[model samples]
Target: MSERATPVKPTEEQEREQSRETERPSDGGADAAGPGPNADGATATEPVTTGAEAVVRALENAGVEYAFGVQGGAIMPVYDALFDSEIYHVTMAHEQGAAHAADAYGVVAGDPGVCLATSGPGATNLVTGIADADMDSDPVLALTGQVPTAFVGNDAFQETDTTGVTTPITKDNTFSSDPDRVGSDVSEAFALAREGRPGPTLVDLPKDVTNAVTDREPDEPRVPDTYHVQEEADPEIVEAAARRIEEAKKPAMLLGGGVIKGNASDVCREFAIEHEIPVITTMPGIGSFSEDHELSLEMAGMHGTGYANMAITHCDTLIAIGTRFDDRLTGGIETFAPDAEVIHVDIDPAEISKNIHADYPLVGDAATVVEQLREAVETSPKAKKWRAQCQQWKSDYSMAYEVPEDEPVQPQFVVEALDEATSDRAVVTTGVGQHQMWACQYWTFTEPRTWVSSHGLGTMGYGLPAAIGARLAADDDQEVVCIDGDGSFLMTIQELSVAVREDLDITVAVLNNEYIGMVRQWQDAFFEGRHSASDYHWMPEFDKLAEAFGAKGFRIDDYDEVADTIEAALAYDGPSVIDVHIDPQANVYPMVPSGGDNGQFALTEDQL
Candidate 1:
């Protein structure tokens, strides 16, 4: 039997008070831009610029370097303002692509990425991407056009409730009602997106508001006074947590996406290595710690490494940093970490015990709290034998697959070949599916901010657009590659045009299986082999489609063609596509059925 420790919880009254305090800013609203010249050097007396100009000026003041969007009627004025600005804007083929591109930019650039969309259909198109950002806690700012204030309720041609539609998915949203305050409203949204527990935020711009003339400038980006974040954990809690770590017979580190977002990856790596603690990364936390290190157990949860899941199940002290104990990672909560006392660290307090219970809840910035533990702990855990056991598990369940000369190409082989072809500075973006799992399982990620994908929302068609944004955000020397499934690649294939027009150097490899592979796999396992709408046999030749879009195209059908095709595609100066045909019946393994124990993951179909 495992011993459990109860965590302290705040009373209902105190919780209610804290909720009210966050909503009511101590300073009534954002500060006025003052009486002097705006960013364009135009004074209030001049009143020479439209509210649209102020909107673009606010972005300039926020140090926005790039924006992604699609042009439409209601948003044309803002686009006109953008035409004269220094910020580089990429006109995407679809609004969804625009939002995904901006989101990927945020993931790599470590700043709040910006996106724009017009009213109605345009606004709705961004919902998927916005929700993806919200679920993953990526910092992004979305500017959406709204119909004229007069026509809001009357249902004007392109009118929709942009703010209302996005309220649930955004960290915060505002309707720019006043011309003078519109710029400040955008500034506030940008600040809120990046300040505390980063997530996407939105600003809705009505036609009348942006069309009106306004010389008032925007306040510098700043969060509201009432929005305070705890920077350090309580000293007593840190000391206690440190003592627990010191006394641990088997300790393990679980790092999540927040480590990279909070700039805590370096500190996490140092702490884990110095103490010889085994490290397990969540799917989103793939690149937070180098997988090649001796103490690393790689990823944990459903499709995670066997050793990583073993460590989570058996460790005596679980140091979980920045993770929210997502269901996919925790499996059955009762079975998860049954033998361990969880030390949960996160910037957001609400996430501490919302999922699995936390024995030591260190609520603060990820890096700051880790530093506190570092200072408090005087001795490392005595886990030499435990470390040996973890290494043994790693050896027992190695990620290896066979490729015969007579059979079809294996997707895993293709992923490993791609990894061998790219430089270490390469950035990878993937759409959600079996291909996503193959890439995650095979690629050796060694740096922070290198792996980008749709984790929480699992949005398909994210790869191509994300590659476009990552290409723009990354250093010139860094390569951007999109690994996608056939079903996923077709959803937003129009984005290839944007890549070609911009002369972006990105390689796209579509692992073609002619089916909704993940769904098909589930049907085979649990649904009694009922493929039902999962077979996508009538798919277009993606390579030919790429050529039609004016990009270099290649095809790889057999094992001999793998390396050369990838090499040629990467050698292309502009955007390139490689359609790699793989075994249609192939399925990803090391999966735990939904809500199954992580320690009891299956390695093959029969086993499952």
Candidate 2:
């Protein structure tokens, strides 16, 4: 697995120097060269670049550095064109890995991540990752190849309706039939993915269209101002929200993924600090505010911190910011914030009343709305009492688990050790399940864009690929960690080849509990402990598997070795996997059963 060098386009000064050299005459003549006509009798102002070249150039203009995918027959034209472009093409073992990696790249890079795949199975394989991006509102551009235009309706080999398959999962989908339009279509796809309420966008390229020769030059990349239009809350609505906050005795704020997307952490923090309001977050909104902040209540609902759930349940006025109050966070609509008057602020108007009713709806960007509210809001007299109560709850209902000195390692302990090792600089990603919840619960994310997970889709095998993407998008010095479970890790474990081949600096900590831990836990709590197919009688030796894939691997069972193993994995120059044998029977505590209200959490063994 050798690394490839893909240099970025030279700076403007370098371009000018190259142009001067090219235009200079070898004979030192007065006239060097003039525009000439081609065989088509058109003035040759610029060399004819193919549609495939146009697509690659457009992506470069848009500041894209990498494109992830597995190549196939229909998509070979784009790969051929990529040889001359600055963008690095990452070849993955599976198309699904490419899609997940691209999705995670979009989340960490603050730009639309690009992924390419072929028609038929390749396009179908991208559906899960596209759905994940749509559910989480991450911006990703999915490009797929199609059968030649003439044979598209004839059901040519390897042909499928790429646009139709991706329509529902993407923000927008389009098919290109004309070679000349590929550049502009690709540009629009990126814009749609990144505009208000960011999501995945799909562009299907016909095989002939990419291979066709075209004289049309690529369109200039759309300016950010053309699409990233920010909406500000109306003054009246802002004032009304402030008035509601002032009137309430006990007020709390619910932060969601929108805050991170809108980059409103600083303003959100200021608003909370000035108003002395307690803050809680949704699963996708974990890092919007620092968990260590004095006013922060961490996560709320389902597997959220007990105090945060209690705070939301008891607050008189609930200010929901950049969040959609999904079922996981709300539990039951009728019981969620039953007594509180809700004031919702979001960039998307549809989300305002989609879930929980908003007594005062401010349809605008979260950062802009928070800034306005900060200017108009005043400290309430009851804030002091509410703050004291929240602090007490945090102290009394802290997330706790007892680790027997002689028993197998607990999953939570592994997360704690990893957190201590990373020191908040690592971008943490997780697959859906117990490992996901434990990572969210135990890791202290002090900054935005540091925590990535498939929240809405809850896709298994998302951790490793997403971590790979995050590492590629992040600064060279930044560390990336994937907290995975045995069940989820195996789903797309083949992605280890990409990580190892690229020499990415990533640490994968596998909580090797030999069962589908979440399902088994649910069975124990709700179904009389009937394991069914949840148990894994045979498991792969992950350390050996890692070594076979050309990466470092470690297997640890003793609790005392967890910290040292994690530190060594992080210190390794290339990708490494630390497989810790965790207690299979260990269950994630402080859970709110399905349809249960925030206040009705199952806390202990007695409750189970």
Q: In model 2, which regions exceed 4 Å deviation?
A: 1-48, 223-230, 379-381, 605-608
lDDT score at residue 366, model 1, on the 0-100 scale: 94
In order, candidate lDDTs are 0.88, 0.84
Question: What is the RMSD, in Å, between candidate 2 and the native fold over all Cα?
Answer: 6.5
Residue-by-residue lDDT tens digits, candidate 1, 196-267: 799999999998899998878888899988999998998898999999999999999999999999999999
Please give each candidate's TM-score: 0.92, 0.92
Clashes of 1: 0
lDDT of 2 at 210: 90
Looking at candidate 2, the ten consecutive residues that score lowest on lDDT are 24-33
Q: How accurate is candidate 1 locally (lDDT)?
A: 0.88
Highest TM-score: which candidate? 1
Off by over 4 Å in 1: 1-48
135: Cα error in model 1, Å: 0.5
Q: Give the TM-score of candidate 2.
A: 0.92
Displacement of residue 421 (Cα, Å) in model 2 is: 1.0
Name every residue pair that clashes in candidate 1: none
Q: Which of the numbered candidates is closest to the native, going by highest lDDT?
A: 1
